[model samples]
Target: MYDGAIIMESLRVGTSLEAFPLILRRLSRYAVKTASADQPPVWTEFVFEVADEHAVELADALAEVLDQPGWYADFHNDEENFVIYPGRVFRYRRGDQLARAEAQEHGRTLGVPEPQLDWTD
Candidate 1:
């Protein structure tokens, strides 16, 4: 069974400090795997999972909520992941090392400094 699972690894949300609560509220419905917060700089990391079908909807929602100069989101799933800062998307298979390497190479070609080329559990 495929399970239609979408694991979001290292989902970094860059937004105004004031908007974090709202973003958290909006994503509360999903199953959060890990969440981290750092003071002084106020950076956060949210790792969550949702049905594969809902990935795009979630992305759109986040993009809308974090729409600002320094606001961006990075997501990693079985198919592809986005580096919003550079506006790049790379595709890779869940367990295929070769595909992941290729995707990373492709990302480099597109100017992504450090592409995530590993599978997320």
Candidate 2:
């Protein structure tokens, strides 16, 4: 097994049907694979990478949260940020500043409580 963490970003956002494919695409570089949901609402396999023991601890915490039905987790490097939604990306530094600006300019609606900044942090 490799050393990494997974993040399932949301639990009951929008709908699982629309989110899984996008999640797969974003993390494809890490070789993500899917499995049957076995439970209702379809769940897909999510895998990613982290560097050390602390990351491993973080990964375990993420897994615990994801164990609930309809959720998943995949962690990426700290330097790398995540685009939680279409046209909406977030990083550790600015939070949702850039994405919010674009949303305002285009009059686009954005999902709130941005997912990129983990509540645990």
Task: Quantify all predictions' global Cα lDDT against the true fold.
Answer: 0.39, 0.34
Instruction: Look at candidate 2 and tell me the lDDT of residue 46.
Output: 41
TM-score of each: 0.37, 0.25
Off by over 4 Å in 2: 1-26, 29-34, 37-47, 69-121
Question: How much lDDT does candidate 2 score?
Answer: 0.34
lDDT of 1 by residue, 1-121 (tens): 1112121232334532232222221222343222222111222344444456655555554544442223335455555554332243333446666665665665445443352223352
Model 1 scores a C-alpha lDDT of 0.39
Per-residue lDDT tens digits for candidate 2, residues 16-115, read: 3221212222342222233223223332334444344344444333433433332333334444332233322232323456643543332223322223
Give RMSD to native, each candidate: 8.9, 13.3
